[model samples]
Target: MTHRSSELSIAFALLAAAAAFTALPQPAQAQAPAASQPTAAAAAKTGLVDVTGARIHYQLYGDLASGKTPLLVLHGAFMSSDAMKPLIDPFAASRPVIAVDARGHGRSGGVDGKLSYDLMADDAAAVLAKLGVKQADVLGYSMGGSTAIALAVRHPGRVGKQVILSGTSRLDGWYPEVLAGIAHLTPEVFAGSPIETGYKSLSPAPDKFGQLVENIKALDATPFAYSDAQVRAIPGKTMVIIGDADGVTLDHAIGLFKLRGGGDVAAATQGFLTEAPKARLAILPATSHIGIMAEAPAIAAMVMAFLDDKAPPPPAF
Candidate 1:
């Protein structure tokens, strides 16, 4: 099949998923969102810190005191830290991991307050400060990925090597259909989804799920994006990962990689030897927007490869 055909197929499929959002069956009961522990069994801690007009919620797995760089994991909009368990488990097993619930999300506060990507990124930094974490590697999915970019651009010192999963720096990076779907999102659409139930189970204000949905809609309506200079100026090395059929367009993903000093040339070309890209890009096959998050093991492996970064010695021929 042609590549364009595949993209259209994915786009239509994504639309179908979007339409199903409001049609999900209601849950029988709500329970506290599950706490995802490390596979290697590390000490776990949870905390709340004040940032801007909200209280941010976070969970730390593994030992902070070990002094190894921590990995900050940010969930998609309306998703709790708990829902990121698949990605968290493997990273936690290796080094420290911080899973955050953005303001007005999960167990955090200010459900109806104004929010910007810069503000959300600042909140993550504030949480790090409260916990006395100086710097961390970041892995953000969807909305979290957008915030991760802001964090790197705004608080360069607070981030180490970073990974952006299914994230776009500009809103236009997403397909128009996807944005339309997001525009149509109503509290009723989440009446029975984990996004709603998780909020009910873990939010400090359990009765505010509808308000949270409204907040997300408003947040999406606002234009939140970084300039080309801002993206090019990010000090740390970066890796951008996406599913073949993700909401982020292939062109945008390629643009991000290029903006970050990647895809300058083929790796083995002589020109590449003089100027290798400090960034990396991966497009996973047979994966969609939602499917990418669930493929944690594979994703974690790619993350570790980037983190480890053992390059072969240059040939002398």
Candidate 2:
């Protein structure tokens, strides 16, 4: 199945699911504690760290002394650490969460050269070293997902558990149009325009549009490429999340399913028993490519539970 067809099938499935669950409200307590909330002494010790001439910005959440696995959340292309606000809130309440602004995005300074996944992975490793965190559960969304995979392959010891949200293992056979669209996005256009406009055209949401644009601009400035061999080389307890109705057709989903352990983006996520195998898959329902995390709290909750090493029931097909 091709990527485009797979996207379409997923979209149809999501629309059907949305019609059935339209009455649902936003999950209460979904947002993280406001900055005004009292900070634990441990949390207060947070500070930015400089890495490879770029001052990588990172904020540590929760009490590190608790010994819970620290989580490192990587944002997608053109997105800053702020993009992680939704997932970070709950995950930080129990274990320490570190959200980073990849170089040239958010607070991090840009460097001259083509952006590569290896370099981004190096940035992640630098952040881990700066925090004195020998190992951490790493989660990446979109572009960050590719980075996480690189980290798992390059610095296996630094990553405990790995999760890739809306991430793919290889760029091979990716929708050519998607790549062409991205390739044509120049840095000047990104700096002068509202980035969200382009994203909303692909997926609907206004809140994070500007930030998304900024991240996209950064990606343009630092173009990164990876090979399928590099992607498959990653070894860790890895989990992948994708929305069944992400506008891509079911053929795309089937192609993914044919990979070593891929399956429906929403229905295949039911086997994540904590005591059993450490890795699994999840295909969230009624979610598009962009809003998967926002529409499905269960997806985020599953991620949090996995990062925390707590057992949670897998997705019910």
Candidate 3:
């Protein structure tokens, strides 16, 4: 055949093959790999509850079937419910755990005015009431710890036991650097940081990031001071855990324990009893302020033992 004719034949053959391929029934698309099951920590049931005037976002791990006391967890400043992920699954393995994002943080709605510990504590109580939880053990870290103390004080009936990690009743318990950091929580301070990124990533009003920072700074500056008398009055069993090198001074933590009827009286009178004691003061060794929560394994073990009445009482000064 001539070159031109051969070319035409080849072209026609290619077209025919293309037509045949097109006519063939297409195989069904391979099912997209089933989405991986959520990790236990991420399997928490999340929801929003109207607590007082603000919408509170929360995560619940485990269920009532565990037959253990429910634990109400609160995170530190500039953090969300996500911050408690490390402790959720492990704690939930034995009991139901509830963690929340206070106003202006995470998926929770913000509020007007400064975010005082009293207001945050009230918010937590409101949330517990909304959840129909008559009483639950309360755990708080840093800012959350302050809120936990307020919760026990203001809504004493709602808190059966209180765990304050890296928390203090007095504002001055914090290191100067921490106070300075709180004072400097402007948008510029958090610029390009996870705090800023997290806020903008999920906030309903991302534009209000600057406002949130301002509110936090204001809250920090405003005194959330609880008197020694006030600390002495909290009715619930309490545990004050602080890192040896924490921003909360050791002396301050001792004062807190003493007010709770822990101090030297317990050590001298009670000695090292075989049973769980009412109040405790734990100064974790080789730890610092930021690592308090990150040391969840040790914290959880200590807390769980105390809650279960399996561990000895906290040592006295």
Candidate 4:
């Protein structure tokens, strides 16, 4: 059950976890390849935006005037825009929300090379530019969260704020079991699983499933991580959200928060902050990594409040 500790992984585990957290057997609606043709009954606008060397599929909810700042959503590994639709809808009513399918996942296309967080982060910024959005509050779930961290690091000017859910900065931030689960994600292991099925059904190039698996396996089997200094260098507000039993360990989450200038509370100042925390952490009770997005309504409320600088004061523990 051992894997190369340096190897970066998590393609299968995310999709597997999605199934584990299934509330119902809802079918995913297919998205058109381009945004030119908006379906009559579509709540969200779907289309493809050309990035450096790939076409990234994206979905938009609400109009630009919905709010001053738009929320850009990044979906996890092995998932498409369909998976993030539910979690982002509630926020759409009040503000603009954009969900993107990362390279090689959902209906997006990928280059014939390795996948890295920096590359994906660049793609995200490019997609925003293509859509006429200069700044946005970035929110990434699972692997998407990791991408959000990278986005903030490389393109700080494009990101207004960050909300990382079920994501970690270092490879070691994940639990041992969680690492193991993602490390063993071979094509055979996911042959008939929902993850594979969904990919086959939604991918623009259905025949590229094996290639996608190999790319993900390579990504997971490699050492792709951001340093604490790199994370600390990101200049913006960040919120770290996770479940009590999430894939990321509490200690690691705290470490990330502290790097972002959080966890300085002490008795000297009565543990009260004269100013708000640049980095905030929220661990939901009785929640797990797989079901974190399902708690989107609550998560959205907190994020909206944080973005508006109206977050409630922390309770004494």
Candidate 5:
């Protein structure tokens, strides 16, 4: 193959895999908002909450007690809260934004050999409880979105409206290529990349990036699916968002959406005569797993609108 063909092949491979967290803004982009909006640092404050097996680090923007439900933002594997700024900035403009750096990632510490989504969910709840938030909305991307699913599933009362962006309910929901790519998520692949630099800059155990990867791999290797009954039992309004060309299979996305009470034939037959389903699904065009967060502001707007569920009576002015 020609050099350009090889490059294209590599690019396509990356697109086919959820190889890494997709939303790391270029260091220069920190100051460059995708739109005219608050920077990540605007009104932001940081904290660490002690939880079993982890000292979870979190950043907050806006006031938790400002009365609007806070939006808890979680980053994917190898990403820091900095990665969530796109989703955070828009939410914080209207409500509190609680961005957590999950165990062994970013500034969070106290990594254990058994760090699962359940543990991460509990850690997030502990932080919210510490801040006296009984319940808040959740918006998580990638692995963070899986953590959000675990949170809503395990602690239904703690999550109000939940948004799962590029998250999977079952490991098999991922395309085979993406599943195979997990083994490539070694520290060596990330060496000298922002994933490494970001961890070193923010992690208390900066030397443990390799360990973090191993632990995450272990977590991934563990069985991670809930029975259909368990998923349907959760009593929270949920939205599942995915890119059309994402690592997640469209069939899996639709199945998960249907499991969450997504739209059905009732809508086509009777429009307003029927109530909307509690679940929402969005499939963005021309997007892939790696570019999911490139349009963060737009995604945030959809999430905000979903959570802001107030509605006027009807077609009357």
Candidate 6:
């Protein structure tokens, strides 16, 4: 979702209702709309609905005739529904595809001045319920990846399969300096000043450096700490993907990889496969965190294939 500068002001106002101050500068561009307003041409073939609480926006494509399980795409932080655009056309051609703007991003509404994974999970549930979808193959990228895990834990019945891309089971010690830097920024700086230097250490594309900086700033600055035991409890088919070069010292991705066991795609793959034998991991050679999505079509294809396999069989003639 793209937001105009004016809408950013409104969003800041809304966000401030719960907190006393803001942490990030507004992006130079307006906030993307709450949802993509597809053209009539696209609308006829798709369904758009606003889930309750106005916190979830979903677009459904493809008919149930295929009997294929629906695929739900969730985006990373500070990103809008458009982030999943690359996979939508291909995935929707065979099975139903639904992409959402998580609360506080894109077109989704924020909860009463606070952002919590539980609330985000609730928003996902609301969207699924609104569509009357019993189960879906889910894939979340980056922040959405964590949100997807929360959904599986909170609403296991609704998840047929799950994929976590460049995501983590816990947030503690992930990026202390980055988080602290974001918290230190004043609302005025967040809304008008350039982003701090900490963000540059993580993002590959430094062109929109300020935007990336502000995005981290706008994210739920509240510290998030999750338990390893809590993550192990998530039930369903699952996979974890990460690049070798992610993090300050390559520790971010390496740590998560090690947490799964031994920091190799094979080891992580085996861990997940042991639980859900069908689960697998793909480590893109020479790919970094940000570069993985754009540079690694194979990874995306693998995810699409997993969703396809989980989809219900096509309807009979």
- Itemize residue pairs with steric clashes in candidate 3: none
Q: lDDT of each prediction vs. the true structure? A: 0.78, 0.60, 0.73, 0.76, 0.76, 0.55
Shift in Å, residue 221, candidate 4 = 2.0
Off by over 4 Å in 1: 1-43, 266-268, 271-277, 312-317
Q: After best superposition, candidate 4 residue 7: deviation in angstroms?
A: 15
Candidate ordering by lDDT (highest first): 1, 5, 4, 3, 2, 6
Give the alpha carbon lDDT tens digit for every residue of 1-317 in model 3.
87555543432332222212212332223112235212355488888887665788888887755667899999877777776665565677778889989898888887354588988998888778777788899889878989999998899888888888888898888765556555644476456666677777767678788888778778767766898888888887888999898878888888888888785465567556766667887897776676455466567767887677676546776
Best by TM-score: 5
Model 2 Cα lDDT, one tens digit per residue, 62-132: 76568787889997665556556656766666678888877655556643333556778898898889878
Candidate 4 backbone clash number = 5
TM-score of each: 0.84, 0.68, 0.82, 0.83, 0.86, 0.64
For 1-317, candidate 6 gives per-residue lDDT tens digits of 33344445433332222121122322223222436322221331333345444446566776644677888888765555555565465566567777876664554544223456766777887777877889888888767777887788788889877777776555643445434444444435444322222222222343344444344554546556456565545555666676665322245444443443334467456433322234545665565445455432355556765655554234466
Worst 10 residues of 4 by lDDT: 24-33
- Supply candidate 4's per-residue lDDT for 62: 78
Worst-scoring 10-residue span by lDDT in model 2: 14-23
Better of 1 and 5 by lDDT: 1
Please, what are the lDDT tens digits per residue for candidate 5 over residues 1-317? 87555543443345222323443442333233547664554757888998877788989898876888888998887777877766777677778888998888888996544678888899999988988899988988878888888998898999988888988878778776555556546667666766667788888888887897777667666668966897888787888999899878899889888888886677647545234358888998877776677767567666766888743135544
> Ten-residue segment with the worst summed lDDT in candidate 1?
24-33
Q: Is candidate 3 or candidate 5 better by lDDT?
A: 5
